[model samples]
Target: MDTEMTSEGVAFAKQMLADDHAAEAMGIRLVRAGIGSATLAMAVTASMVNGHRMTHGGFVFALADTAFAVACNSYGRTTVASGGAITYLESTALGDELIAEAVERTRRGRSGVYDVTVRRGDDVVAEFRGNSREVRPRA
Candidate 1:
């Protein structure tokens, strides 16, 4: 697990985000990178707020998902999440910086599993389960 796939893979992921309407709209930023892990952050602005003025759950989910994608794909051979889900345990308020970290869990021949956590300071906001599909690297 490298921070990004390969140098080219990293560039490719960045390029993929160019047309990602949600990524662009949410201002998600890639923060930390590792072979088996990736970290991401997003600011909770009014646009991300829910009716209660707290951060929307969808916004948190997207941040966690991006981190999961990066961590699972860091092998540079192209891995796509096959099956996964997440649970929201707590609400994060707007103006709080949301951070997500994806950690590798298990792997089979062509698939990998991971656990992603979203947090605000010391509070755990959400938990995510991610499954990755490993594919042959493009030459």
Candidate 2:
């Protein structure tokens, strides 16, 4: 719904999509990307389950983290996560579609924070917070 990203920003996102083999391997799909926000979705597969037969927290975290990465880097600056954490609130089963929405919380100088909420339909499944730092290109 928000359309504030520049054409170059969109191109940058596409480039990321083309090169992100890890995310693609997990079946993560990009839904939308804006200046400081992004939405991605993935489905829980049998390989992604834990001993309890529920989706692994790491996989969910990966989904949210990918969204956070895309959102933070959507502005076209090469960025990397300084740190990140996730809190799981619900469990999902195989074939369940999960969506992660990342939004920029704040940006100061070369550092920024983002919040990613993972959901199963309308239910909240997990929450992620990521700290990012923009890395300058060499002169």
The candidate maximizing lDDT is: 2
Per-candidate clash tally: 5, 0
| Candidate 2 lDDT | 0.90
Which predicted model would earn the best TM-score? Answer: 2
**Residues 1-139, model 1: lDDT tens digits:** 2244446555555544444678778988877666667788888998989888888888888898888887776656678778879899888887899889999998788889999999988999899998889876568
Cα-based TM-score, every candidate: 0.82, 0.92
Can you tell me which runs of candidate 1 are displaced by over 4 Å?
1-21, 135-139
| Error in Å for residue 3 of model 1 | 7.6
Per-residue lDDT of 22 in model 1 = 81
| Candidate 2 lDDT score at position 74 | 86
Q: Least lDDT summed over 10 consecutive residues: which range in candidate 1? A: 1-10
Model 2 Cα lDDT, one tens digit per residue, 1-139:
3334566866686577668999999999888888888899999999999999999999999999999988988878888899999999999999999999999999998899999999999999999999999998557
